[model samples]
Target: MLIYSILFPILAIIAIIVFFFRFRSGKLSLSSFFIWSIIWIFVIIFSIFPDSSMVFARVFGITRGLDFIIITAVVLLFYLGVKLYYKLDKLEDDVNKIVKEVAISNEISLDDEEEK
Candidate 1:
């Protein structure tokens, strides 16, 4: 009957399809799959019952449901961004450590061959 009524289900279905494809293709990790599934389920629930957001906003002293959603989304995105950055940095450090070890080992073996 309404735009959201039509849009929400479409978006939810698309997200589910993407999730399945990514998971099956090994592009998405198990933890990420569960996290995204929960996020999509919440999106569907909020889209279907927007009035709940209003109640939530009132409780939090926010003026509108849309504003509450926007603020929450922004904060969540920022947090996830910081988390991913740290994870990538740690991975890079690990790779560098492994590479350094391999290089040192090869250098030692080369020296031994020269000594022989």
Candidate 2:
């Protein structure tokens, strides 16, 4: 067996354990845990049986199994990155709005200060 076949599965198992712990600790939501588990499980499965990925390559018209896996990983990562970027932008806008409201509400007028 190829070394990566063994190494990848081992690494994937470690990742799954981390995800499980995070889920138990409430650091990861159920939906996120499920998604990450599915991804890692696939990694373990495919690494152990590299030929299984060949089926996907044939169906997708990819020239090689490794190519298919790389392409899929790239696409998934790009989608996740875009989602994160949008979420972060929304959070920044929300924080700015809240800060502006708080500042306005807490402001002390010059006339009020002079009267003190």
Candidate 3:
């Protein structure tokens, strides 16, 4: 429990730093980072309580802290999976747009060469 309390916050801090850097570089969306940070904070807060496992077990019908952790982790992983899927979709759209622009430029260049 003590180790979890310490490690959870440290991990959250690291995640925040990474997200901030990515956002600043315009590689990440602010909304996604903000939502992820909020979830991290919740996990950190829950980790601080020794009885958190018990609470989670009672409230969620889980058997143990490890189980609760697994459930939460799985849920978070799924959420991130969905988020990444959307981001990939956006990237694909951006790539298609750039490709179309390049094709148009090439066509115009070909027309100019023909005229000359």
Q: Highest TM-score, which number?
A: 2
- CA-only RMSD, every prediction: 2.6, 1.9, 3.2
TM-score against native, each model = 0.77, 0.86, 0.68
Instruction: Give the per-residue lDDT of model 1 (tens digit) for 4-29.
Output: 87798689879988998999999998
lDDT agreement with native, every candidate: 0.89, 0.91, 0.85
- Please report, as a residue range, the 10-residue window in candidate 3 with the lowest summed lDDT: 49-58
Report how far off residue 12 is in candidate 2 (Å). 0.8
Counted clashes in each candidate structure: 0, 0, 0
- Per-residue lDDT over 1-116 for candidate 3, one digit per residue giving the tens place of the 0 to 100 score: 47888998889889888988998899989897898788777777777875676776778888787788788889989988998999999999999999999999999999999999
* Tens digits of per-residue lDDT for model 2, 21-105: 9999999999999998999988988988888888989999998998999999999999999999999999999999999987776
Model 3: runs farther than 4 Å from truth? Answer: 13-34
**Total clashing pairs in model 1:** 0
